[model samples]
Target: MKKVLLVFCLIAISTLGYSQISGGIKGGVNFANVDADGDPDGKTGYHVGAFLTVGAAGIFIQPELLYSFKGAEDFDLTYIEVPILLKKNFAKVLNVHLGPQFGFLTKAEADFGGGSQDIKDELKGMDLSAVVGAGLNLPGGLSAGLRYVLGLSDIADNDALPETKNRTFQIYVGYKLFGN
Candidate 1:
């Protein structure tokens, strides 16, 4: 995890030296679910973040910092997530995005009819995921997109529990802050 973060940072820093930079804030709705034994029900949550894009000529590297709420029914988890994406633009109105997302678990809770209990210690501290999406870049800096996040790492830390992974579908809107 540390090595991955270091590499991402180095790439971002190097790209900044020569690439054209643009960025914006975004927020969205998340449909989150867990892939595990018994098949938990999906939960609706939210995410808000900022993104920075560096590159030119229709290709770009975009790095995003986001606070995301994700979990299944009766369970809630909060994560600070960083996604480094390769974005390709087409026709000035359409784009495709693919990326690796790194998530750090910040909070976890489970409800068992009686009340909510903190279950943070039972989960892994870091999560790795892949993201794929498409977007429409509208006129005047506005944009809308959809993304699917597929977890690549097991989140359950307990040996006795079934392996658990996260899956999320996101719908979001954004407006470019500057640059081109």
Candidate 2:
């Protein structure tokens, strides 16, 4: 995990030296769920984040840092996630992106009727996911997009438990803070 993060950082830093840099802040709604032994009900959550784009000529490298709320049914999980994406633009108005996302768990809880219980210890600290999405770059540095996050690593900390992974669909709006 450390190595993967290190590589991503190195790539991002290297691109900054030659690319046309742009950045922004974004926030959105999340429809989250867990794919496990039994199909769990989806839950509503949210995410807020900042992003940096490094590149030009219709292709870019975009890296984002986000705080995401996710889970399913009675379970609630919070994560600080970093996604490094390859983005392609069309006609200066439409774009598509795909990437690998690394997530660090911050909190976990399960609500049963009257109260909630901490379940942080039962889950892994890190998660790996694949993200794919499309967006529209509007006038005045505004943008809107939709994405699907598919978990690739099992989140269960115990061998006795069935494999569990997070799944999320996100709808977001963003405004560029600086650069082109």
Candidate 3:
């Protein structure tokens, strides 16, 4: 876990040297659910992260690191997620993004009237998903986007349990450290 974070930081630091490279902090609400019995029920959670974008000729590659809180009802799961997106800028105002996202489980717990109990042992360590979204580019590198994350792998660890997959809707606002 530490090594993964370190690598992300290293890439972030390296992006600072280029005029076309920008990185920033982002945080927003997440409507997360599991696809067990259809839409399932979503618990509103939050995600905070940092992202770096490298662009050339209106095309860009963006990498983001985020800590996201997911799950709902009786259980809550926390994850450290990495998303690498390919973006196409249009009219210098809107950008469409699509790519793969990887998630590492950091914590898992169940809440009852009594309190909370750790359930990490029963959970899987990794999650893979697909992300698709669009962002509105603004001055000063401040931007906003709405995206959906659809799980490509089942998160269930036991065969006895139902087939579970993640579904998340995210809306975020970001501001680059340096003006564009």
Candidate 4:
């Protein structure tokens, strides 16, 4: 019984230490929207980030640091967002990811009667979001993926304008630092 227990511990330790680490840069564009109360319109934005991957077999975890721009076009509202997700590969060239995101209202620009001007505080300051996506590995160590960012927290404080939330779709291109 003692010998069996020792062998079991050794196997477990070996498996835990056999993971590989990889790092790379990723960037993408977002089709964003600020859902107020009624119709939802699309806006243009983008994100840039760095990622670290640790994995064994077909499963992996990827942690990313990103700077993202999000907004609505008709209303002309924008925010800076950061998202982190854990990813798992189910096939040799396919994977899925889901995680949480937080955003800060940075600069807001709008068109007044005379001309466009920068506005100070039109909405809430911070927002919380949920992210989910799928990825495909391409040729030459490159990968492409698409993600959806859905606002889970309200960003509006005014009752007249209605509570608003953010929704976005992002397409990403990335390079694998290390993985099989």
Candidate 5:
């Protein structure tokens, strides 16, 4: 994990030169849920973040830092997630993104006033996922997109409970402040 993160960082930093750099903020709605033994229901949440887009032409690099809310009806989780995506531009108005994401769990608790509990131990410290999305690349960097995040790691600590993973569908709008 460390090596992968380091390599990604190096690549992102190296690509900043001789490329277009655009920074922007985005906010979106999350249709999130967990696939686990309990069959917990899906939940609606929100995520807001900022991103730096590097590169130009047919290929681009977009690295984002987002505050994400996720999980199922029984529990809610908050995470600080970083997604580093490689994008390919098609024509002038279409773009597709594929990437890996790293997430750190910041908050976890039962919902519906189930009361507070130290449930961090029951969850994974770090979450890993793969993201795939498509966007409409409009002029002036204004854009709207949809993404699907598939969790690659199991979060449940107990062996009795079925393996749990995250499944999220996100809709967001973005605008570029500068650069292409």
Candidate 6:
């Protein structure tokens, strides 16, 4: 058992060292949807975040901290979200990603025709989602990625109320801090 543990530890360390573990900041726009019976209203919510990327031969792990706003038209729901993803690289410039995401609600607002109102008490404060996407590395250390985030947890607290989940499409531009 000791021999096996030692071997595993060494392999883990070597893998980390082999992978390009780079940290940087990222931010982007979220095209968001509140999943209703039909196509939910589309609104542009924004997000800003930082990410840690660990990339190796053909795989990478990216974990991000983001402030995200997502909701349908006339509503503004904001939260802080954490997403961890596993990525598979197909080429030096292209990769695919998928993972789990969770969020804590910070604020909620609704636009009445004449004014806006807060409705934080009526909704759930926590959100959970699954994310999948792909990315392309561009010239000058710039990278672009698109992700689809599907909400798994209901946003409504009352079971009798209509349950709505969120679907968000995010496009991000990232810059690598370390060069290859």
lDDT of 4 at 129: 91
TM value for model 5: 0.86
Query: In candidate 4, which residue pairs clash?
Result: none
- Candidate 3: residue pairs that collide: none
How many steric overlaps are in each model, in order? 0, 0, 0, 0, 0, 0
Off by over 4 Å in 3: 1-19, 112-114
Candidate 1, poorest ten consecutive residues by summed lDDT: 12-21
**How far does residue 106 in candidate 3 sit from its true spot (Å)?**
0.3
Give the C-alpha miss distance for residue 1 in model 5, angstroms. 27
Stretches of model 1 off by over 4 angstroms after superposition: 1-18
State which candidate, 2 or 4, has the greater TM-score.
2
Regarding lDDT, does 2 or 5 come out ahead?
Answer: 2
Candidate 5 lDDT, 11-83, residue by residue in tens:
8787666577779889899999998876888999999999988776778889999999998987888999999
User: 62 in model 5: Cα distance from truth in Å?
Assistant: 0.9
**What is candidate 3's CA lDDT for residue 165?**
83
Q: Is candidate 1 or candidate 3 better by lDDT?
A: 1
Clashing pairs in 1: none
lDDT of 5 at 48: 95
- Kindly report which residue stretches of model 2 are placed more than 4 angstroms away from their true locations once superposed: 1-18
TM-score for each predicted model, relative to the true structure: 0.90, 0.89, 0.85, 0.78, 0.86, 0.89
Could you tell me the C-alpha RMSD of candidate 5 in Å?
A: 5.3
In model 4, state the lDDT of residue 5. Answer: 100
Deviation in Å, model 1, residue 177 alpha carbon: 1.5
Q: Which ten residues in a row have the lowest lDDT in candidate 5?
A: 111-120
lDDT of 1 at 125: 100
Question: Which residue segments of model 6 deviate by more than 4 Å?
Answer: 1-4, 37-40
User: Compared to the true structure, candidate 4 yields what TM-score?
Assistant: 0.78
